[model samples]
Target chain A: MKILVTCKRVLDPYVKARVKADGTGVNLDNVKMAMNPFDEIAIEEAIRMREAGKADEIVAVSIGAAKTEETLRTALAMGADRAVHVVTEDDIEPLGVAKVLKSLVESEQPGLVIMGKQAIDGDSNQAGQMLAALLGWAQGTNVSNVELDGDTANITREIDGGLERLALKMPCVLTSDLRLNEPRYASLPNIMKAKKKPMDKKPIDELGVDTAPRQTLVSVSEPPPRAAGVKVASVDELVDKLKNEAQVI
Target chain B: MSILIIAEHDNAEIKGATLNTLTAAAKMGDSVDILIAGSGCSGAAEAAAALPGVRSVKLADSAEYANQLAENVAPLLVQLAGDYSHLVAPATTNGKNLMPRVAALLDVMAISDISDVVDADTFERPIYAGNVLSVIKSNDATKVITVRTTKFAAAEAAGGSASIDSIDGSGDTGLATFEGQDLTQSDRPELTSAKVVVSGGRGMQNGDNFAMLDELAGKLNAAVGASRAAVDAGFVPNDYQVGQTGKVVAPDLYIAIGISGAIQHLAGMKDSKTIVAINNDEEAPIFQVADYGLVMDLFDAVPQFTAALD
Candidate 1:
């Protein structure tokens, strides 16, 4: 059984984001980008599954602009056998991106696929499910744990309150949430070897997948800033204010 | 163009997130049609029918919709999607799971977690846990979108006497079968639904100390929450993490216990109605925006406060 891991390059989580002055978009003039955190977990899991002898080979795939190859290399340094880069300069809508991946899956026919549950950037948490749905495969999302049996894979997901355990048939898709596993950094030796690893590009056009976008963006605006609150003297004053002024009670 | 807002729900009740999606749909276009595709969920349809701004409510109740399985909802939406130019769902777990399939089935790209609509075919979404925002334009004819509900207000419960309409089930129940469901019980309103919430952080020490937050929650009738630090430290589970990474909640009252109010943590709960802080550190950032402040140890103040409530 082979595993395909999906990842993306997004803005680094530590950088503070600022809206553009003209309000056209984010001010990315100097913002640095890195591999998405959850996708890091996805890469690590696929490599672990392969090393554990649970899978035959592990392949890493990334979708984004040219610099996103940096992210695939990051995945390779973490030990994926090969890489598939679906090159698109524009940050295409996730559904289009998923369609490109569905075509990749049809070509690869991997027994299992894993991806980060949500990209830290959009926080949409939809691509993995969309990919599974397009492929007509069983799926589990926000997964913290996964166990593969003969023809089925068991997934432990982080739901709203507690965890839900699901047993999915083989050729399934899984998206990772936090606590799934701590992603390991690429060792110096592996980082050096990753340079030589096969990094193949699949121009989305060659995939024969329709990348047509459906949604139209009307306006992009910043969320209203939180108003500074009035500080109360004591709990008594708070309760009184709640009852008399706020009328929450 | 008309917008189709897909409502997310179990047979029991519609999630508050669905109402927020309606709030977003109202911003997008004049006409709105909601699809409540779940099994025997007349309750859900009734709720959708009552939404003040909606023109039509489409109910596709079926036993197979018990899971609201993506396979089923995808084809149904695809079949029903032609009439409307846009299709949308709340970016909840169910919506995230369902709409991608519909987008794929339609052979069009779908946008996820749209915070603001840029144009009819463009949007701005945050990346890196809201640390960065990206504005992009879509070239698709009829866009599919999933929205983060925290940004929108819940639709008012105005009496609108709406029409109750039905559509045939998309019934493409593929191979997956219904396994049993495990529901978690809590007395307080859900985080997304609660008007108030009190959350703990690593400063609270351990899981047992969570009781202090719970007690305060009960007093406030608020949901219980925890910081990602608390969850990462194993003091609590991931459900409690309130940051760019976890659930986003905007409640009427918010109390932070022993939390320093990291920017990431603030991103999750900052939209709350009123903020309160109970931390030992006098300079904790949580106090900076708190509506009420207790510059004392949470361990000591929590018990005293709970006692005061009792």
Candidate 2:
């Protein structure tokens, strides 16, 4: 069975992203870019399944500018067998991305698709679920644990209140959450080997999916900063301040 | 324009998050109708009908909706999409799971976790862990949205009487089956709605150390929570997590113990009326937000503070 994993290039999670002065989007110039953290987990999960003999091939797909090939290389280094790059410069929304992935799914016909629950940059958390809907397949979002049975995937999902276990038939979509796995670092030798992996680049227009933005980003602004606070000298002072000044105790 | 608010309930009663979503919907327009889709959930429909500003309650009762699965609920919303100009729900797990699928079927974009309603078309949402806010405008004729409940106060549950109308829903999708769920049965107040919240971080070391937080929470009648690091370390379940990706909580009082206050965790509780941080690291970002900061070893300070209260 073949597994399809979706990877995205995002601003490093550790870096504080600033909105552009023009209010269009976050300033990405000179910002360090890396494969999305959750997508790393998805790639790691796919590699694990492949090692366990459940998957025969793993394909990593990414949609972004030409620079996204670097992200695909990272996935290749992490153990994906091949890479597919859908090159586009537009800021595609969740629905548009899902449509593109749906096109890929129809063509690839992979037994399973794995992706991140949400990108740290957009935080939409929509693409995987929307793709599943488009494909008329089962989906497990925010999946913390996954066990592949004969023809079904038993997935443990982290929801708002607790954990839910679901059995999704084959040809399903699984979105990885933070606790899914600890992503492995690419070794120096593997990073060198990833350069030789076959990577196919395709134009987004070829997918025949509408990539227009359904919503317009009007402006971006900083949130109201919390006022500067005081450090108490002792626990007694803290309790006294809480009781007398803040009145929250 | 009329708005359709999807009610989040448990068949017995409506969750507080739904009421908050109703509050957000009422801001968009005056005529707000709530859709209660669940098996044997008339009690929840009654609760929904009583919420202030709700014009009517639409009930879709069936076994297909017993679990409120997205496959079942999204199609029903799509089918019922003709009457309303806007579809809204709380940005809970169920809403996040269901609304995008509805938006996809309706061929529209779903605006997620909107914190403010600039107008019927425009909304304000947080990005970059709430450090930055983006104002977005939807061009779609029928708008789909999920309200961030923490940003909106819950609507009053009493004083209004709305008529209940039954609506038909689609049958089972049959793509997936719910095996079971393991919900943490706790008597303490829910983390999101608690008046006071006490959260521990990775410094808690192990799951057993969370009992110290539970004890302190008991004294203050507070809810116990954990930072994402603590949750990832297996000190507690994911439900106890207070962060951007986890539960967004804005209590009256928030106490952070040994939490270094990553931006993600701060996004969840920074809106609290008062914040108290106790950590050994004086330079922790949590201290910057703490109204009362105490730099000390949590293992030593927490027990002493509890004893002092006793």
Candidate 3:
């Protein structure tokens, strides 16, 4: 069985994101970009599955502009057998991305589709579940653990209260959550080898999916700032303020 | 416009988050009908029908939906999607799991975890860990949305009478089977709905030290939470994690003990009404958002604060 893992090039998680002056979206000028951390976990999980003899190959896919190839290369360095880049300059929504992934799933015929639960940039946890719906496949979102048995994937998901287990049949979709696994760093030798790995680029339009935006961005702005606070010298003073000044206690 | 809210519930009772989602729906006009799909969930349906502003409750009782699998629930939602102009759910783990599937089946893009409903179509949502708030307008005929329950006040649970209608269930797809669940059974208030929240971070040292926070929580009738650093340090379970990746919480009073508020951690609790930060490091980012800051050792301050609460 082959594993198809999806990735995205997002603003590096550590960087402080600033809004554009015009409030249309985030300012991406001269900022560092990296594969989404959750997607990195997805790629790592796929590689582990192959290493455990559960999967034959790992094909990493990323959708965005030319810079996305760098993210695909990182996945290759991490252990994906090959990479596919869907090139598009347009800002696509999750539904559009899911449609495109559906097209790829039809052609790739991978036994499983794995990706991040949500992108750090949009913080919208939709694509993997949407893709599963489009393909009429079983889905396990926010998955923290996975175990393969015959033709089933036993998944442990991090839910609101605690963990819930489910057994999903093969040809399914799984989204990686934070507790799944600690991602591995690519070694220098592996980074050099990644440049030699095969990578295919396909223009987004060629996939024949309606990659159109259904939502209009009205504006973007910083959240309302909280009122300034004062420091309390002692626990007694803090208790006094909570009981009297703030009236919260 | 008619709205269909998918209620999140176990077989016995509806979750509190659904009441918050109901408030969001009520804000967008009042043709709201809640769908309760669970095995032997008439109790949940009755509870939904009693919510203030709910027009009715549609119950789909079936064994296939006992576990609330996205595969089974999404199909049932799609089957009933034609009558409603909007499909809404609370942005809990269950809502986040299933709403997108319903949206995809309807071929409409969804707005997830909206903090503000500007109008029927426009909403304000946080991106970049709440650093940037984006306002959006959807053009879809049937809008799909997941409400950030913490941002909305929960509707009154009683005082309204609405009709209950039994709906047919879409048979299971045989794609997934329920195995088991390990739920944290706690006697304390739930973190999301608690009036007060007291959270710890790595500076707490270890899991054993969390007992101090628990004691403080018990004093104030609060819920205990932990920053991602604390959970990553194995000081607490993942469910105790409070962050952008974990749980979003907005309570009346939020106390942070020994927490150096990272951006992601702040995202979860910054919406709180009154924040109190107790840390030896005066420069901890948690203090920036805190309404009250105390620069002291948590080991010394926690017990004193707990004692002073009375």
Candidate 4:
């Protein structure tokens, strides 16, 4: 069975992102960039399925600027067989990205498709579900475990306060949660081999999806700064502070 | 057009988050309706009717509602969603589970986790945790959205005039159930529904060190949480990981201890009404938006904090 995994390039989660001085967008000159943390889980899960013989081929796909090839290469280094780049220089919202993936899936026809539950940049968490909807496929999000039958996929998902299990008819979309899989590091050997792996590029223009924003972006601003307080010397002090100083209690 | 707020229930009681979504819907427009689709969930609809601002409550109860197995809830929502101009649900596993299919069925796109409603078509949401806010306006005639209840007030029990009505059941909707529920529990808050949260991270040093905040959390009647880094380092259970990869929360008071405030983790707690930080490094990112900040070593702070709380 062929497994498809999706990833995206996002500002490093650790970076204290600053909106551009001019407000055009975030200042990226010196900031770190990497594949979204959740998407890494997706890549790891697909590779694990392949290693387990549950998948015969793993195709890692990313849709973003040309710089995203680095992310696709990272996925290949981690163990995907090849990569597909859905190119877009400008940012594309979740719906447009899903539209592009849906069209690509129609042609690729992988048995299973997996993605991170949401991206760190936008945290939309909608692309996988939207793709599932557009393709008439079943979907499971926040998946902790996946069990596949001949033509059905049984996925255990994380829910509020507990877990729920559902069976989806293949082909299906599954979004990985934090506990789904631990991503493996790219070794020196794998990193070298990744450079030799096949990588293809396609554009949202070719896939026939709207790359336009549905909503206007009026502004992007950093949240306000936190307030200040000091350490209390004792539990009694803490209680006194809660009731008297902060008065939160 | 009217808005549709999906009722959350397990054939037992309505989830608090569902009413939280109602609070968000109340902000959107004049008319709000709650949709309850499950097997024998008319009672759930009756319960939902108790929320304020609901014009009516609709239920399509059947055995199918029990599972919330998307295939069933998807079609049920799509059939009912046609009349409403806007669709909103609390961004839960259930709402996140079914709303996309409804969006797919309607062949329209949806905006998820809006922190604020701008107009009928525009909204504000946090993308990189709470670090960066994105204000988006939807062009779709029919808007579908899942609300971040943390951003909206919980629906008040002040009472409303809505009535619950039982609709014809749609039976089974073709989705299959494979596994049942088995949960992992934590001594802290459930994350999404916590009124107060005290989270720690790598700066906490070790697993046992989390107790510093544990005492404080218990005293606050809040949940204990952890950043992804803390959880990944085995300082805490995965259930405590808060960020894009972990849980997203909005609590009344959030105290982040010894956490450097990665944008990912900050995204989870940025919506808290009051944010208190304990970091030795004054430059720690977690201090950026903390309502209260302490630039002191956690070692000195934790004991002092625990002593004060207990």
Q: Rate the local accuracy (lDDT) of all candidates.
A: 0.79, 0.91, 0.92, 0.79
Superposed Cα RMSD, model 4: 2.9
In terms of lDDT, the best-performing candidate is: 3
What local lDDT score does residue A73 receive in model 4, on the 0 to 100 scale? 98
Query: Considering lDDT, where higher is better, how would the candidates rank from best to worst?
Result: 3, 2, 4, 1
Stretches of candidate 4 off by over 4 Å are A209-212, A228-237, B184-190, B200-216, B233-239, B258-260, B278-310
Task: Write down the TM-score of every candidate.
Answer: 0.87, 0.99, 0.98, 0.90
Which regions of candidate 3 are displaced past 4 Å? Answer: none
Which lDDT tens digits does candidate 2 get at residues B59-111?
Answer: 99999999998888888998888999999999998989899889988888899
Write the residue-wise lDDT of candidate 3 on A62-95 in tens digits. Answer: 9999889999999999999999999999889999
- Better by lDDT, candidate 2 or 1: 2
Evaluate residue A151 in candidate 3 and report its C-alpha lDDT on the 0 to 100 scale. 86
For model 2, residues A90-174, the per-residue Cα lDDT tens digits are 8889999899999988889899999999888878788988988888888899999999998899999998778999999888999
Q: Kindly report which residue stretches of model 1 are placed more than 4 angstroms away from their true locations once superposed.
A: A20-24, A27-32, A202-249, B50-56, B114-128, B131-139, B156-160, B281-295, B308-310
Specify the poorest-scoring 10-residue window by lDDT in model 2 chain A: A234-243
**Model 1 RMSD to the real structure?**
3.4
Question: Which tens-of-lDDT digit does each residue in B1-310 have in candidate 1?
Answer: 7999998777667777888888888777889888988888999889778888888888898776777767667878888889998899987767777777787778777777777775566677765456445676777777888897877878975576678888888664554544544555677778877888889998998999897788778887888988988988899777777887687887887878889988678778876777778888888887866767777777877777676666
Error of 2 at A73 (Å): 0.5
